[model samples]
Target: MFTGIVEELGEVVGVTPTAQDSVLVAVRGPLVTSDARHGDSIAVNGVCLTVVDVDGGVFTADVMGETLRRSALGTLRAGDPVNLERAAALGSRLGGHLVQGHVDGVGEVLAREPAPRWETVRFRLPVALSRYVVEKGSITIDGVSLTVAEVGDDWFSVGLIPTTLALTTLGTRAVGDPVNLEMDVLAKYVERLLGARPADAPVPGPVAS
Candidate 1:
């Protein structure tokens, strides 16, 4: 599990495809790499990846076929910047929320506009995932937790403060760029529970009336 709080902005130093339909990604993240272990999990751009190797300030993780197919990591190239975060420790303050570091779906940045002190970014939402998002709800984009300021049928907007724009990868995103998105964990759970048994579903017969 993760908090969806980006701790470092790492750069992809190299990408080598493996024979098993996985790709080895070498990233440079001094902070997150400092104490990383061989099997520790790291959230790369919101995708939970296990540490395959670590050397100095660089760490490598394998992106399996499933992750590549479901996330924007496949679109990344050498030298691209990515948000990085280690798994949340036990008993830590839930600064953000319960983030599985699982990318639900990829979204595209539709627009960006500057405000007096912040910026508003509009992202094109995938229809299948729209039901999990709501106005004022929390969403994780590239591993950073953000609040949804507005929502439409196929889009949602977020207000980015200066800190966010300066510390995370979203600050430099361009229009049409793909981003990893994870909807609210609570929302997903609630949806699942509510959908399990429909209101019209017949209840168990009471006795043998």
Candidate 2:
């Protein structure tokens, strides 16, 4: 699991395709790989990928077909910056919400409005995922967790502080750029529970006389 907190802004060094429908991705993230080893999980742009090899400050991971189909990672190329975050350790503070590093869907930047202190960026929300987004709710975009500042039928906005604009990949995003999105897991769980029969509902007794 990840906390959706970006540890470093890493760059894609290389992308090599394999015989099967998979690609070997090498990323340069000094901070994330300072103590890294094989078999560790890293969240790259909101997708949880297992470390295949670690050399110097660079780490390589294989992106399978399913992940490519579901995320914006497939569109990445050498020199593209990515938000990087190591898995959250046990007993650590939950800085962001519970993030599975599982991309729910992909969205595109619709607009960006810069303010004196912060900026509000609007993104086109997928029709299927729009129901989960709410004003003031948490959402993860490209591995960085942010709060929903406004919501519409097919779009939502988030306020980005200077720190976020300077430290993460979102800072470089422009209109029409695609981003990976993961809605709050708690909302999905609540929806599931509400749709199912309640555990507290009494079983039907034999029709009373």
State TM-scores per candidate.
0.93, 0.93
What total of clashing residue pairs does each candidate reach?
0, 0
lDDT per residue (tens digit) for residues 1-209 in model 2 = 99988999999999999848789999999999998889999999999999999998999999999999999999999999999999999999999888999999999999999999899999997999999999999999999999999999999999999999999989989999999999999999988877786778875679988
Each model's lDDT:
0.93, 0.95
For model 1, the stretches where C-alpha displacement exceeds 4 angstroms are 198-209
Displacement of residue 88 (Cα, Å) in model 1 is 0.4
* Pairs in clash, predicted candidate 1: none
**Which digits, one per residue and each the tens of the lDDT, describe model 1 over residues 40-125?**
99999999999989998999999999999999999889999999999999988998888999899999999999998999999997
Worst 10 residues of 1 by lDDT: 200-209
Quote model 1's TM-score: 0.93
